[model samples]
Target: MLHLMIAIPAFARMYNVSCKMCHVAFPKLNGFGQAFADNGYVFAGKQGEIYRNLGDDRARTFKELPLAVRFTHYVAASYDGGKAMTDFQSPWSVKFLLGGAPNERINFYAYVIFEKGLPPFFEDAWIDLHGFFGLPFSLTLGQFQISDLMFMRETRLTRSDFYIYKVGPYKITYHRGALLGTPIGDFGVVNGNGLSALNGKYYDDNPSKWFFGHLPLPADFGLFGLWGEDYDTLGNYVRLYRLGLDWRGVFESFYPFFQILVGFDNDTSNLFYGGFFGVDYAPGGDGVVSLLFNYVDAPANSPYRNERLATLALRYSHYVLTNLKVFAEGEGWLFKRSLALTLGVDFAF
Candidate 1:
């Protein structure tokens, strides 16, 4: 399943506002949406503070559970190498999503998956506390993607992925960690082992950790670095470093974004580099068209060798309602010499 993230409809229900207040579409955030997130999942001032606690003085609770569901269902057809295939992949992913202010200073976000496996799993479960100790900083602790600080796919408008974040040679996306940051910048240290660490009771057999620092630059640009010194499963000594730069711009109805990263590993003698460029164009009413291209260049020792790897995708999404969108995308996976077309629906409510 290709994971999908959303600006949950719960906010719309709680604030009594239209979904468009934060989203240009179901998952694509507008400028106001970025501000809402920066302000602890609420509107500026006291508008988002209108909720009344259902609990007593000592505890604050919601009058209604602030929860929503997001899912994807798709039909994919592709020709890879010499093989051609077509299939129905309905319910590609189903998520129980929730996020909101638990109190004045704390906003939390999480999503649990219900795919093929029983006893569903959590993809994101983090609490963000603003103005900690009455200072200018914030704190976040839980499981999340470090890549978000560099180039967040959660708010992107494409059905395809930002492949750089998933590249094996410089991988640094998922884990459990504590982050100290503000809107301008953040620093974090997470278990260097990825999701495996979270599944293993957040335990680490090695003492090393992954360290990351991100700073926002002027003009909607950002820079970040990730460092890791750890041992591989086979006990091979490893030291990895990554540097990324991201930028985004909006011209009326068109929004364009670009992100690139360079990574090196001393132990494996591997060097990796890649980036993705995408643009979203909303000409008018209820519809969005997006184009994305991701490319990677890896050393010969890496899985993707020779720099002959890339993916190009074009997608169109139409909102039938605020919480439901139907989309179709045509993609070329240059790495596998495959071409695909997928018809899908995304629902968030």
Candidate 2:
């Protein structure tokens, strides 16, 4: 399993507030945090005071650069074949998060990730344009995780589960053009011009591209759409177009949410659809219990054609110091029939 971490302390510094103000735990955003994000990372309270030169007619400047670092490590033991293998290893995933509003209307978020045995890469780079064209919508541009529009997989503490957001249809390659001098009726066996009649040009394939927008409606409801192209393990290319609707609200201390996404794979003419309904019960402070159900359906020719996932997780966290946190969580996946117990710590400075 890939160990991914997401914790941003820059928001705390930007808002001059405790991490609890926006997060139920280390990375899960609370109601206030969601609002802050919706506003493009501009704090509703004491905004101008957090930064310098708010009245400047020139480029916006920060009193101090908003940057934060996070490190996470865990130890685990798994059971297999009536035996247990215990290992003490460091996931050793580190993240450098940087972003904040240059001004009230514009906000940006970016992350540089370094992981064990992997070269560093820029992940989740995006700029948020709040209230686009004086409408109740926001425009986000850059490479981002489309799953975030529905369920926030980053916020979940499960290490042994696969959710619908992580599953999709298989890729299908398109024959753009036949190889030169190849028979028009023959769609097989020719390799020249770097374009094979059997297999189209695989070289110089670009990475996936994405564009999405979000609109906030009344009653804590939101709608979004995403369009992009992705490649599968077989090197087949697929185009993804998705539309989603979500509703979230807090009642007392419980946060209830529902999300549905309808996606289409244009290349293969397949349907990719899913829904996630869950509730986070945050009694208070830094402890949260989550129950979520996820269901996805894809075309028969696609991988993960009829996969369904459900997860139940319990988490507790405590601050050892102002910038250090200790947490332990246990989660189980119903379909995968797996359980994971994790004891980890997070520190930010």
Winning candidate number (lDDT): 1
Give all candidates' CA lDDT scores. 0.79, 0.59
TM-score each candidate: 0.91, 0.70
For candidate 2, write residues 1-349 as lDDT tens digits.
Answer: 0001133788677667888777765567766777666556767757877667657567678887889888877776655445666666475678888888887767777778888758787766666565546655444544355445445565653343325555544211111111111111101111111212232445224544444444556797777665666665577776677677888888987877887877776744566676767776767754556666666666677545656456666656666764576777676656666776778777776
lDDT of 1 by residue, 268-337 (tens): 4577888999999986588889999999887778644655479999999988987798999999987788
Best by TM-score: 1
Q: Which stretches of candidate 1 lie over 4 Å from their true place?
A: 1-6, 45-50, 53-57, 116-119, 197-202, 301-308
In model 2, where is the ten-residue run with the lowest total lDDT? Answer: 178-187
- What's the CA error at residue 89 for candidate 1, in Å? 0.4
User: What RMSD does model 1 have?
Assistant: 3.5
